[model samples]
Target: MNEHDLRHLEIPLPFAPQRHSMSDRAQERVQIWAMRFGLLADDAAARRFESLGYARFSAYWCPTASFADMLLVAEWITLFFVFDDLQNQAITTGRLEDYDRLRHTALQVVYERGVTGPVPPVIAALSNLCTRTFPRNSVAWQRRFELNLELWLIGHARENSFRQAGRSPGPAEYPRLRRDASTVLPTVDLAEVIEHTELPDALYFGPSYQEIIATTADIMCLTNDLHSLAVEYDAEDTINMVTTLRDHRGMNLSEAVAEVRRLIDVRIADSQAAAQSITAEMDALHLPPRIRNGVRRCIRDCQSAMAGMELWDRTETVRFTPDEELGATRAIDYNNGFLDASELGRAAPADSRRV
Candidate 1:
């Protein structure tokens, strides 16, 4: 197979003797697949990723996790994986003009939203990965890496669009979204990955789901921040993700509500646009029905979520404070630091390059 085909590939379980227990054996399978394909980061990094929750929800291979509460998480990830696969293909001698359009559209979103609109870590890491895999100046390598980064940013916004759309109001043009993949790979033993990174368990949830509900939760957690960007943006340094905006004005009660409404409007437009794009693609090319259906569901669900999300208000947050600002501020500051690290190149000042 070509390199593009291998972009999101998973390895088969590694071989070991001594009759490991079922769970350990299962975990070994996860390792085998991850290591063979390079998914297994250093143990400490993995730990950080898991500790931070990246592993819990985004380990795409283990299907047992559910996303019911946050079904969009699963959709966004599934979408990310697909986009990654497609980008790999594009970079590896497969080009689709529409993809360029998509990438630009996403960049537009980020530009409009400003610095807080994007995250960069995955792109940077993937670029580093590409440098290791292909010769410098390889168009395939450059495009492939570029596309992955773009998709991650777009996925960041898209997932929120799904959440803001909320649960279906019952059989609109697009039905509510759901996934049964978690049933495919139920147990994701991440101990090995945890040891390698500082990523934290939230990453695990991004890819962990035993059923659809859990998968959705994972997906939602990843994207819900966009819908609740207000919460994350305006929250005290103790618990906010949009740190640049943490001290910025306009995050107060009334303004936050207004932003939600405005975001929902944009999401609705996005939903319509994505659907149109997919439908146009369908006119000439044939794709797996499952993917088409999945796209349809994600589009509809996210649109609905966006609508309901407009109702999100500052009231949802607890405003009580201690006599003075406490160390709790670091909770969000730390997460933001991680996010900045994740952005491709210098989402913040300290985001220096590392192998």
Candidate 2:
């Protein structure tokens, strides 16, 4: 996509509510599940969860879900963050071998249940999620989700290898790795489970439909990289879109941030176009009314994901703030919203949270 010369850019917001009404229920579920998974094993762990705002983060994914489904989805999101926090610690501590072992153990728990041994909290959480969420799902859906999770881990390992060798990925290579590493696909996959409707294989695997999901992932990844750029930079992490662009394209930080914003807008436009095209194809296709409705619902869920997540990124979480102190609360300047050119900076200030 060509970078447009523009004075200001507005990131799209979800027309629907950013969160479900059962905020209290969602919060309680996260707490109970965190305890069950041993994520709140100590004061330090409890403090970290409090700082991350897991409940706030969970509310953003599906705004209209039933309380039961919302609880499942929130716990699922918790599983991701807990796993992510553990991996970040592993990487920060230079425990690459331990990280590898953790990956192996988690995957085994996901794919080969009933393995006898003590399971860690992360894996325990994952195992519980798999049983609760996937029992009635299609084998194909299960496999797709499994592959997405596996690829995410693989991407992290690949990025770690580059760090170990003191190398930076070129602009092209970075997106390829980031797509999987970002774990957007599996996140989007939840639209099916929470909505309780599956897109049939023919529609799901169609070119236009796949494009819609990929563009959704692309949009999410760009927004995330931009949001987290400052934090990653502060940590001296090189495996990020901003850093990759600066190193590979020889641009300064401002140039990279601008380019990434342009890319996010471009992906948003592309996903809209793809959604329209897929809808037309669905209308033209002669299918059972139920199946047709399922496809339509699936499409709507994809759109909801974009809006929900955009709202969450801008308003809910402290994961991308400039301050290292995670416990402090921050206010969101929606007027100075995400993708606004005027708000562009190395990172959101300690006072302002941005997507």
Candidate 3:
């Protein structure tokens, strides 16, 4: 595969709906999970981001439940950044709101009923396990991404979208914009969320984890929608997650599911065609080879996990009277794991071994 395709695999083409940055707390959750996995010990990383108020305020966040997928999700997030820079544009608010709503609804449904993707086809509660388990760097990296997400909205919104690309107005304008953002997301306004995270002291990533997190997160979100083809079909009379849960668009679940599968097939083809794009970026940017390897591992792991959780299996379906499964909301009797994440441990390696 060439560099373009490699980059495409690392990143992705933005779809109709939009994507958002992982919150700082969500990043912290990852750190927490790593701690359990013996990933890291001290709070040095966390302390750096803590200073950036934006990183601290919202915390690192995700819409999936599977921790293993966070690697893909992070990649996906990074891809958006790439697109954002390339297009000389940020993301849109309509898309951000769409994903945000999906995240909130997923959290609630998972909490109350334990249903997973029923919230939104593209969204789920799987990543929460990662967030609840690990957390982002306190202020450094988390703050930058958090603001990037907000700025993305600034360019994409109807009223606030900026005509040109450049730095935001300034800190002075933040207070008022915060009030306006409150209108849409009362508690988590655009400015407020941007300002909440703590700033990083010095850019302090060890060898390389960026590609790992970004690539993994991207793969998970994309694949989830693909795997749920039947459930997402609007004409198949199956359960359509996005229509029913987020926008309340009446769609046939079975039909939507088939369509989603077809969509994924095409995405794979596109990735194949664009493999050179990745190597091109790497060569130009000169990212470390180890970072590329980490990215590869993430992709491989996600590929395996997706294959393992193949939703095609009958057992994965939601029965009208679905067999009793633990509801997401059901109280956890965390005997040993209530505090220590190590007890629950990370998901068994789900991705396939790379050829």
Candidate 4:
């Protein structure tokens, strides 16, 4: 699609966009936390990060989270974007070895819940996040989060391999890879953490719930691809859904975008169907009201996340601009003492510490 068409493209998400009352405060905290960990190199980098409006994105994604919980979610969003940009650079430069090592260190930090020695600032920041967030959830939830994260990391590796080989996955195989690479699964898991509700394993793993999650991933992924088409094309990235359709399905740019829009509508319908089916089943089984409500809330949150992503892309984020250059020259430095993993979860004076 051309620039004008892309700008005017309508993403028909069902949920109303909403933001938390503390989005500005949470944004400030995320900036300080990012600078403290050297995720932002200097004032320019800090300004670039702030312009992405990730804290607002997080607020929209988890509109009901408490201020403290919103802080955690915003931090996670910041880490995700920082890591994504770094990985993109690795892929662009064909530095697969570096990408693999970064992926390994990230997985290690998430799995171990702490760092044993000196590591890159990104890895150290992740370890601190894991330490603070993991202990708050059940073992089941933790395992699910870890698994989703591993899949996300592996998905990046797969994309890097594809890029290195100068080949795209067949359309049949692209969606699964795209879903994993989208990182929406773990984002959903974090939403659960923010909501302070965990679905029992049986319900969470059931066909209906899994379907809803999968469809939500598709919607979010395709919507992102739609909005980011111009930027990715400029970057010579061909893994996006729009590019996939044009390259593999014998469609033009306009045709490919139309097909993607159709697919997103279908996925939205499927998600709603799965949500209704699961809620009805819960009612029939006489599940506790709390359990049913929690399930409902989870589904609603997924919709909110979808809406938030589209809204952020259209109105808030500077990420799709060609000149944005996310993560450019942003080195990981850990000299700022706020990265101490031991101090992560502890309550301290506001100026001294913030998660």
Candidate 5:
């Protein structure tokens, strides 16, 4: 509730920190890419976007990726930030129709590829991303990524419905919704792509692996809610867990913050245990050395992602800071006529040989 409570709150994460060697190059590439798609209005807007440290964030999550893969990962993170801001604006302004339309456009871009006709800058950028990245991975990975993306979009709609009704989700219902809405699952899927490895369907959907992913999502959502608490509270956004706990669970501000922090700790512990369980299960299965190593690497990637996100939030990103302090100029309006539709089109079909 108070700045002091948030400032003093510490969420412990056990993973060691790491950063990509190509982070600076990746950052520069993403800025240019964003400008090409009209996501950044001008030099000033580009600078503001850079100040957000998205490239560093991506680098932390994917420290071992090649330069090309790192750039793709950074681009995805940048797109997520832009999409989140635009969606938040739509929901806050009660523009549910626009929000729904944006969701549909995004889904279409991923599902159909090379979407023709004019679209918003974000959608256009997404189409470009999919065209460039999808062919590098397997059909199975693509399908998994698409499903997670759909869940994330649907989760936004669910949150918007609560906002339109002027109500917060009950505490019991929030965790499930937050997991999908956080978009962490897709990022996890991206890890597999970046590593050029895939888990068999059975291992991926197993209880232990699923638990690890769910706990990671919970940790991410709760950590974000805590860091952005002051900003969201100032904006009167009631969708965050802290707000939900305070309003729906009848807890005071201090109590709510403490409770959310407590929940994060619990989830972190659960995530570690799940990781251990999955490793043991893999050993028990006596899988081939290659498959075992791939699975283990994937698990490490998820832990790295969690740690990377926390480190970026704490040290690099200016997102939780006030706009005035950062001299931020561009607003989150994707329909402001800045997008050029000339280059927008459907991507070529997926190469069946990529898998």
Candidate 6:
């Protein structure tokens, strides 16, 4: 890959995203449910959460779905953040075994309906989400989510192992890990849930539709990798695409970031094309109006999610801030410091980096 001097880049977004009305009520519901679910560990955690601005983040993740469904989306988004935070802590603190046990226990809560005894707050929250989300959806849909959740936790475990061993994934291996490591797949599952559309297995598994799903997931992961690059660098995390390209491909930081941006455009274009193919296929089938509408809604939800991800990053979120916006109010180390391109020269190589 040819290196580009992208250290001081301000690349424009390559796609036009649909706009959805954001609800403060939905954001507030996330905060309320977050507390009820024991999403925070303590007062200190709460303070740190405020600095992270997850309420706004959750709002962005949820589209213009109904109020009830938005509530569900908000809760799900909050639960994911809670789970991710705990998992990251485990990895950073060298508690991989504890993280594994925690995920296994959480999966138990998800699978066993009656095993509702005491568990960790994150597990309890997930149990509630699974119980609430599964009943309205198909068993197959629930299974998809269960498998995706499994993959997510497994990816986290893999990352934890890497962290323990001081290893960073190469470019070839990074995307596979990212598919599970990030919430990309789960977010697709959420799109189905939020749309209240159980897409027929035939359409969902078809090559063109699957392309849409994969491309959309890639877009989500790349968008996040771009927006969160600074924060991840600040935390010395190596799971980001930027770092992976730089380390494995011998590109500089600027080149890696530019490549990530280019990949974002490519994925978005592929997703758009796949979406058109899906529409054409739906037309050819001449399916029932209900099924056709549901399929369209599912595709729309995925597009809306992509738009949300893009819009959220450009906003004043705590995770992606300008260099002048230094000095966090809370006492937290995870991406709590300022970052600029100048810091790249001072950054250690991939092997020396750890979260």
lDDT of each: 0.30, 0.65, 0.30, 0.76, 0.76, 0.65
Clashing pairs in 2: none
TM-score of each: 0.30, 0.82, 0.31, 0.89, 0.90, 0.83
Clashes in model 6: which pairs?
none
Q: Backbone clashes in each candidate structure, one number apiece?
A: 96, 0, 100, 0, 3, 0
lDDT of 4 by residue, 1-355 (tens): 3843574366878877777888888888999988776677777777767787778788877788789988998898878877788777776665667667677767767776766455556766787788888878899999999999999999988887777776667778888999998888888888778777888788778889899889989998889888888777877786888777777888888888888889989998999889888976676567787777777777777888888888788777777755444545333332322223443333222221122
Off by over 4 Å in 2: 1-17, 113-116, 283-285, 324-355
Comparing candidate 4 with candidate 5, which one achieves the higher TM-score? 5
Candidate 5 contains a number of clashing pairs equal to 3
Model 4 ranges with Cα > 4 A deviation = 1-4, 284-286, 324-355
Worst 10 residues of 2 by lDDT: 346-355
**Candidate 3 regions with alpha-carbon error over 4 angstroms:** 1-140, 144-254, 273-276, 309-355
As a TM-score, model 5 comes out at 0.90
Runs of candidate 5 with Cα error greater than 4 angstroms are 4-9, 284-286, 323-355
**After TM-score superposition, what is the CA distance of residue 137 in candidate 3 from its true location, in Å?**
5.7
Relative to the true structure, candidate 2 reaches a TM of 0.82
Candidate ranking (lDDT, best to worst): 4, 5, 2, 6, 3, 1
**Candidate 6's residue-wise lDDT over 1-355, tens digit each?**
2112222234455444544365555666665676675665466766666656555555544455777877787777666666677666766666666667666665555555313544445655676676677677787877877777778778887877666766678888887787786766776777777666776767777777788777877887777777766656666787778878877888886677778888888877888788778877776666678877777776776776676666666563565653435465423432211223343233222221111
